[model samples]
Target: MVFRSQRLSWPLRKGLSSVRVKARAKRRLFGRMLAMKPGMKGSLIVVVEDDDSIRSSIAEILEMEGYCVNAYPNGLAATEALKRTEEPCLILLDWMMPVMGGEAFLKARAELSESNQRVPVVVLSAVSERAQGQPGVKSCLGKPVDLNRLLETVEKLCLSGKCA
Candidate 1:
């Protein structure tokens, strides 16, 4: 009985280990990057999302495309980061988040001084609602957003300097 139990457990343990290895590899590929340090240009982009995997993937993708990325887990954290930058920023905002939702961020952002208010926010949410009319929102992207569309929107906004 002991030998039989050991054999069964061996296979299960092997399978579990393989799964763990794969997950770790995926994270290593897309989850490790340095945050934009102080004195770095504020013209860089800011990604605000609650999901760790989603935020890491987006930050990795954008960074691979040569964009400087600063990812935050919530709107409040991103807002605090925004206050420290001297230059205008491009923001990719998630609608639902703890510690201040995207809507509140937009409102608070609008109330900020002119320098901070210049940051253009692009909403990224699973819902299909448009964000065109929202204060400080330049556009909206339905999630699981397409990489091409995301890049295009960023380029258009970042290159043209048009957030209003």
Candidate 2:
């Protein structure tokens, strides 16, 4: 007897939406050339996001673009990692998370040595408005994040030496 293979329906299939597809394509088109500037390669970036997929995706993208990325599931883990690693050029932080949120993280970050305290942070949150004027936060971008804007912000900060 021969077995037949079955295809999943649209609803059952996993795939990206048109907007996401377009965004990804656009990112691929420009991610390499626009991601880093001269002398920016190997600069580290810390990503603190509770969502696994988002964290991994951001890390993968940044790594492909020649920056070193350290991703953690929450603020606590990221803070711990920060203590052990060389200072990152920038930090992309999420607002809400278990085991430590962005606000608390900022407070903790402020208490670290002066250099650590000065590392630029870009808050990614639904409530980005609340992050404005927060110490060490250079910028805030709302979620779901715009890939273009995110890349632009990273490039600007890292290239301009503002993040250091």
* Tens digit per residue, CA lDDT, model 2, 11-83: 2125666456446655764675576465575688999999887788788667756678999999999888888
Which residue pairs in candidate 2 have backbone atoms (N, alpha carbon, C) closer than 3 angstroms, thus clashing?
none
Return the top candidate by lDDT: 2
- TM-score of model 1 vs. true structure: 0.69
Q: For model 2, state the Cα shift of residue 121 in Å.
A: 0.4
Alpha-carbon RMSD, candidate 1: 10.8
In model 1, where is the ten-residue run with the lowest total lDDT? 1-10
Residue 87, model 2, lDDT? 88
Backbone atom clashes (below 3 Å) for every candidate = 0, 0
Q: After superposition, how far is residue 131 of candidate 1 from its true place, in Å?
A: 3.2
lDDT of 1 by residue, 1-164 (tens): 11112111112234346456446545553444344324332247889999887788787656655567889999888778777864445889999889998888888787677877777888998863746678778889887776678878887887774422
